[model samples]
Target: MHSSSVSGSRPCLHSFKTTLPLKALAFSTMMLPLHSINASKATYQFDTVVNQNRLIVVSVENPTTVFDKTTHLHGFGYDLVRSYANSLNVKLEFRTVKDNASALNMVKSGKANFAMTTASFQAIEDKHLAGFSATCDDSSVLEDNGLNVNLNWVFKHANDPLSQNASAYICNTKQNGTISQLASFYNRNVVKDESWDIIQRDLTNRMPIYKASFQSTAETYDIDWHLLAAIGYQESYLKPNSVSPTGVRGLMMLTHNTAKAMGVNDRTDPSQSIEGGAKYYDLMLNRYSNISYPDRNWYALVAYNMGPGAVSQIQSRLKAQGKNPNSWINLYSYLERHKASNSRYGQATQYVTRIRAYLEHIKSTPQLVNL
Candidate 1:
């Protein structure tokens, strides 16, 4: 339950408990109750958690919660819970679970301090565990398939300090419009172009053929395979023979020039194209070497579609406006303006947006469950 109890080992960036399903890497730890004095909060009985060190949270992946998973924790619920953890100056130890029920059970059983909940103000038939639902659920698709998402942090005891503080944090953020800003900020990502039926069909019919290529290519670049798969799906719906008018083709829709540059000889070969795309994507990452990841990943992805020159232009524009150039949320309104004025931003934004949407499905696939 506590860090000291985990064989004196510190969990790396990615870890989880997968009692019910496909995959995870983990060590057992949980959040402990509050100490009698502020100075004593760091101590624990079973050593579930210490205020000065770790705050463990459990969640099922959904857009409203964690849309991504263990490799990199991300999502709206992840953001909210991370903020709360930051307030306490503790490291957040995110634990992924198979369902809402597993998450609740973890909290009740003291394996985590709290659980992040993403329930429909309407119900969703299919579900998966991304970190908070973590990274992938932020957007619906390029189209408007938005839904009202209600997320909450569930605690074991209503009177516990972790619970009370989380409740207070939510209330304070809501009162200050921080929560609203986050919701509005993420509104652009709620796109669902593929119906659940289509997603299932593709999962069954198409995914197995290219899974190894996705896994190998992504691992070479230290990228999540699901994220790479998302980009591929957006490019050609995972069709090995598909081609665009501009001549981008194959599983990854690689242009002839980009493919050649990345050492790919066959544009129609799935493995070659996937490898080429990963290389090109890695090249985009190098273009913004100064920025940190997740943000770097976002920028590189946009650059993959819009060209590094366009991303540079956006950075310059944002800097001129005194905004953070490295952040994707800042690009949203700027891209919207370009779409309004000249319709130039649609393809680039669509490129990133669809990747975002497809990632949720790729991560949520019932059979494969690529975390």
Candidate 2:
């Protein structure tokens, strides 16, 4: 959250008018020595040179609505500024405002380089700011009638140097490839569109099913029946009585050692095997807390299929490459890079890749949820 009030008043300057054109005024003002400014003017002359390379501080809130991991920041205001900076060869900095009020104040006080969010025009119009670029097209339904609340980018006073450059770029660029890639990733990960819903309906009609459990000391943990069924599908196509050539057993496919650690009396028991498998998954998730969620879920699934230590080694390699240790792309890329090598690391990468692809397939299909 942020305070609604401005922290301090802006300094006032005496009024002055310049006959010079905008570009000339900008050039003349920039040429004047930094400390030698004519202090009496209400409107200071703009400085194109100094302002051209200036850093634009774009603000967003935590749990940023602008850029989820799958969605690139380029689709949002961040990308707008980034493109501007690239064109101008200037620098851009991102600041996370504590909340909406702070974001508003940042624009009002000229503290922010620029600000955008899912912000409504009415909420910020009175601040003497320039609202350019509308982001969201519509608002949530209200009373069954279509309602619309526009999301916009806010700049300081209309001709503020930062605002000028940002506006120019926003007017020119069409959606970039970065935006498409991000949208694709988001669709794959978070937003299961209409196709997925249809698949879920079909799967429901089919009701392809399996079951598993874990029991120890007189206590029983029956896995979510559907989850157990999904896991069975992934492991052995719901083969309740199946056994791996490597000595894993049952519908959930627990090894004898894993069954022992989970206190499962029998690896062959469907209920026990499922329970042990789910417990092992829980343990993997706990082990990788530093990884982001949803992604962490994917990594844990991979680690469950491959060992945790092996995943840790891959994470180490990813960190060395300046990639996110927990990101699926980074991990997947590393896996592909190492797949042909005969080294132990290469073998681990191969295993992780297979597990990730399996998880991706499972997520893509509609047989599982609550993942």
Candidate 3:
């Protein structure tokens, strides 16, 4: 259970008008893990989180909703909850679990204050969980009895004081368009649109072919398997034999020089290409160990695409403009602006954003997790 306090009064940041990287880092520092809290068992109740020094949230990690393994909590849910926690002046902690069942169980067991998960109404009724409809993200659950219920997170009790605050936060943010801005800033693409439809179609049809290779690469390099897969999708749309005009080939679209460097004997072979990509990406990650998790991951992705020299130049540009060199948004904005002058750089920018959108979709949707 990693926890941190955010002090000082500052307006919650908007997309383009966001505060500096220092401030963003300050607010985004809250996060979680799960364990028995017998010591605080007596004090553990849903409302106690507000009264105590911390706001404990239990959730599963996904690119958009959560970053479970990172040193800091980020993504969409973190932003929303950070606002609510700061308003109450409590340190926030997100207790991450392996699945929705674990998240709900923690909240029900009083090990957590609130849960962000989805369930059929019958499951909610059976577990006696309180789902806040306002917080729904257009997801649904199919009941064991074959009924569909809107996806939702639940409170411990119907009348828990936390419910009122949570509901207010959702409605207020929705009315102010903060939710939309946050979505745009995080995902950087329209959710479930034509492009999304294509991705989904590919996910169902194309992803299964390459899933095991990615998983194997993940175990070897200790990277998120989905992230590598997402990169592959962005590169060649998951075509195993894809070839760029410049001769970068295969699922990962590795250039011949890069493939040889990574010891990939055949760039057109899925296993060899994916292994080469993973090895190359691992090399980039090693260079970025000085940075933090999640940020380091993003920076490494940029390095992998545009080369570390390019990343250094971009960092120099950001610093010259008084921006944080380590800030992804700053880097993203710089890339967005310079893309007109350099189409390659712009593609690199889109590369990351599209990967992000794909990751969010894959992680948020339960059906896509295993596939």
Per-model TM-score versus the true fold? 0.64, 0.42, 0.58
**1-371: candidate 1 lDDT, tens digit per residue:** 22211100112111222221101101122232334443233332112444236788887876666666546665556666776676666677887776777776676566777777653311221221112221112222212334334354555443333443454455555554445444543453445444656866776678888988889988999888888988988788789999888787898888888888999999998999999999999888888888754557767888898788988898899999998887655665577558767566867766776676677666766676642
lDDT per residue as tens, model 2, 1-371? 01121111111111112223334445665566666455412222124224555654555542212432221232234444454555555556666565666786876665665676545555655565555533212122111121112335565554444444444444334222232222222232232355546544543543333211322311333223443344555575555578989888876687788888988887666666666777887787788778644456556766777677878888898889786787654564565457677365454444443333333444445444332
The worst-scoring run of ten residues by lDDT in candidate 1 lies at 19-28
Give the Å shift of residue 47 in candidate 1.
17
Please estimate how well model 2 matches the true structure, expressed as its whole-model Cα lDDT: 0.49
6, model 2: CA deviation in Å?
Answer: 37
Give the candidate number with the greatest TM-score: 1
The global C-alpha lDDT for each of the candidates, from Candidate 1 onward, is: 0.61, 0.49, 0.65
In the order shown, what is each candidate's alpha-carbon RMSD? 11.3, 13.0, 10.4
- Write model 3 residue lDDT over 240-301, tens digit each, in one string: 88997888899899999999999999999999999999999999989888875566777888
* lDDT for position 114 in model 2: 64
What would the TM-score be for candidate 2 when compared with the true structure?
0.42
Ranking by lDDT: 3, 1, 2
Residue 342 CA error for candidate 3 (Å)?
3.1
**Residue 163 accuracy (lDDT) in model 1:** 42
Q: Kindly give the number of clashing pairs for every candidate.
A: 29, 3, 2
Q: After superposing candidate 1, which stretches have Cα over 4 Å from the reference?
A: 1-63, 68-70, 83-90, 96-115, 118-149, 153-194, 288-293, 368-371
